[model samples]
Target: MTRVVFVLLPEVHLLDLAGPAQVFAGADGFGQPYTLDYVAERPQVLSAEGLPLVARTDWPVLGRDDLIMVPGWRGPVLRDGPVLHASAVERLRAHHAAGGTIASVCAGADALGQAGMLDGRRCTTHHQLQDELAARYPRATVVRDVLFTTDDRVVTSAGIASGIDLALHLLAARHGPALAARVARDMVVYARRNGNAPQASAMLRHRSHLDDTVHRVQSLIDTHYAEPLPLSRLAAHAGVSARTLTRLFAKATDGLTPLRYQQALRLERAEHLISQGTTVESAAREVGFEDARMLRRLRR
Candidate 1:
């Protein structure tokens, strides 16, 4: 089981804590084996939304596979922001040194900065706080206009709802895009990609529309992208005629035909296989390409 620990601070934002928490919780419903825990410097931490929350005071026994997440808090400025005392900072450092992943959202990235994890690492926070974070941690490469960034295992996301994107990205990487899609579907979030986008998988990136028939077809393709799926078959799954499915898919996906979308999924998976040292021919076969030539053409 992967244990996800949320370290709370005084005046933590409600959505920043709840958004990613719900994503992981939804993943748990899908049997992802994530065990969630909440911790705080004090036994009771009040949320910025005026809700009092209770949590454990002691840290858990965490392994390298466990995740420690710091959800952002409310502060007009860094000087007045929540602070992680030296002990908590050391714990964050120790966990990362042991190969455990640490993540932050919004002002939570400031806690990571306090731990020196942001130094020389590409990270992001809420858009409103981006400039201050960059100025405060000059050694850190604070990327702007991104939903989130991961350097080594130190992940940071923009505030509020963007935390959901960060968690979904982690889920996609750990499990597969299929399960991640299911989780997103279960959460009723279309997994938006905008000016600030996650390292979105094809399944999530192309699913930002509200067309039910298109989404149904896309869901079927997500699970069976490596198979040879003709327009007739895809159309049947979406309960539409081939011609209409073609038009709707194109309109919903910025003119991408169903075949094109499936090819994008296949190509993305093939790239991942190739990056893992699989030969081009083998990766092509794994992703249902007839030959490496097609894969090479797509790469070009």
Candidate 2:
């Protein structure tokens, strides 16, 4: 069995740790189960939600692994604390040197950055920490808009819920898309198997100073998803060139392509309709997908 370890830190987000742990622990690929364990710098750690986690082992157990996950650490106070033991850093370095796959959720990237593992790697974290991460790790390409980023050996996820997305991705990477899709379906999270799909978290935080062109384009797509929308017409209505509209769409919508953002909005609306007892076909039509088959195909 492949061994998977989660290094629990003080003030770790409970969901961030639990999401990946459940995915890997439940993943029965290669006709064998994974051996999952939780370790910490000490025997016990408190979660951000006031729950306590009791670890099975301490830092001495850091060894070869199929994967190692680090959940986000405590908030800013713990981050600024000078009491972080150097032994934890050395152990992570040693684990990475031995070719272990390293993954972090949310602010857990801060620990990896502190250990100098994320230097020159493309990574992400919660949007609130984007500027701080960029300032702290000059060599790293810090992206804020995406759910997660994988650069060879290191993988980092943005925010709390994105940890689940990252775990699904890891399952897909290690096992196969089929198994990953199975896990996601089992969790009732249907949209994460396809990489680059727009996540709800992408649009949760509203930006001020609405760009009228982008707003008009999005409003049209939202209200008229069932109708065929010509891109040229949309651009004209927004008073911008088609090419310029594309650029602004990407910038205004957190790197989502215009068409993709529209599709996501439609899907979100479809989900809402479904929750209200609408049939899948009705929901599909309501969301601007003319055919139910197309909606199923795109989501799958």
Candidate 3:
């Protein structure tokens, strides 16, 4: 089981804590293995909205697969917010040093910086504080106007609601796009992409449905998007006739054929590989396209 720890700070924004927590919890509800835990410096914490929260001060043993998250807080000014003690900062740094992933939302980036986790890392925060964060942590590369940025196992997000996007991205990367989409659909949200990717995420683009048959087909396609999946094979997996499966898929996903959905997944993955410096031909082959010609045309 993966342990997800949320470190609470004084005046913490309720949404920042609830958004990612709910995402992970919802994933677990869908059969994913995750144990949520909340920790803070004190036995109790207060929210920005003036609500009181009880938290634990005792820490748990975390491993490489575990995650530690910091949610943003409120303050009169960006710099005047609640401050974390040196011990807490050290805890965050030690977790990352031990190969655990550490993430932050909004002003929680400040805590990460104090831990030295943001140094030399590409990260982002609320747009309003981007410049101040950059100036405060000169060694860190602060990206702006983005949902989230992950660098060297450290994840940072923009404002409050972007925390959902960050959590969904993490889930999709760890598991696959299918389960992430399921969790998103369950939460009634669009699984938007992280960073500045203009195209819709394959998870979100194929979502918006209630048919279990289409969902079964989508699960197979999402997990093995790089394989040659025929209509007959998909029909067999869904236990339906090919014609019926086509009609169901079209209706569930807004007129997208099963082949088109697979193509979208392949193209999305290929674009990701190319963006990471892969050659067109290599990306095409890796994504199950026989040649670069078709992939090029799709990209255009």
Candidate 4:
């Protein structure tokens, strides 16, 4: 059986913690393989929404796990709380070093950032804190617009509801897109879109400055994720050299290389359809993966 440990702190966002718990706990097949536990610095913690959660074990006494999920912190109070212990941080680092997966939701990225797990990696948090997160973790590629990001074994999501998306992504990774889609259907959520789906959020529009070139690129990618997108063609459409396009893209976007950026968009869309209960093969093909084997590899 797989074991998942959720690290809870005072003033934690209840949904940020509960969303993922429900997804993982409801995973189908193998008799619900995961053993989920809520472990905290103590046996009890208060949620930002005023709910009380009892930890299954105190931090020091908790056992190791296949995955460690850190839910978003309450607010400035928890973020600045001197009482927020570092034992969780130490355990997270140790877990990652041992090849275990570590994931965070919403401002939970802040906790992971504090632990240095996000250094030199791509991550996302609630859009409202993107600037601060980027400023505080200069080495991290802090994405403000995406729903979530996963790199180097560290998975991070945007605010509140995005935790559901993150959890579905985890299911897809551990089991398969088929299983994830089932979970999403049972939960009545659009299937977990892959991490790379096109983001149609207002935040991205603001950051893109409504620039014609940027919009064109995004639009083209959205329409052509399944088709081949050569850099030369994309640059030609943008009226710029490939090199110039790359440079401008880095400045205009969230620091993803053009190819990587496109792939991310495709995956994001795929995950969404899957979460909405789309079949794995259909979802992969819908997102432009011609080969099911290829989609499986990339999903992992």
State the lDDT of candidate 2 residue by residue for 31-60, as single tens digits.
547878787768888898999999965543
| Per-model CA lDDT versus the true structure | 0.88, 0.75, 0.88, 0.78
Runs with alpha carbons beyond 4 Å of true place in candidate 1 = 192-300
TM-score, cand. 2: 0.68
Report the lDDT tens digits of candidate 4 across residue range 28-106.
3435588787888778889989888999655433334488988887665334632436777888898898788899888
What local lDDT score does residue 260 receive in model 2, on the 0 to 100 scale?
80
Question: On a 0 to 1 TM-score scale, where does candidate 3 land against the true structure?
Answer: 0.66
Name the weakest run of 10 consecutive residues (lDDT summed) in model 3. Answer: 191-200
Candidate 4 stretches greater than 4 Å from native: 28-30, 59-65, 76-84, 198-300
**lDDT sort, best first:** 3, 1, 4, 2
Q: Per-candidate TM vs. native?
A: 0.66, 0.68, 0.66, 0.65
TM-score of 1: 0.66
lDDT digits (tens) for residues 154-267 of candidate 3: 999988888888999899999997888898899998444546553236776578678999999999999988899999999999999999999999999889999999999888
Colliding residue pairs in candidate 1? none
Q: Where does candidate 2 stray beyond 4 Å?
A: 29-32, 59-65, 74-84, 193-203, 206-264, 267-300
**Residue range 49-73, candidate 1, lDDT tens digits:** 9999999999889999999999998
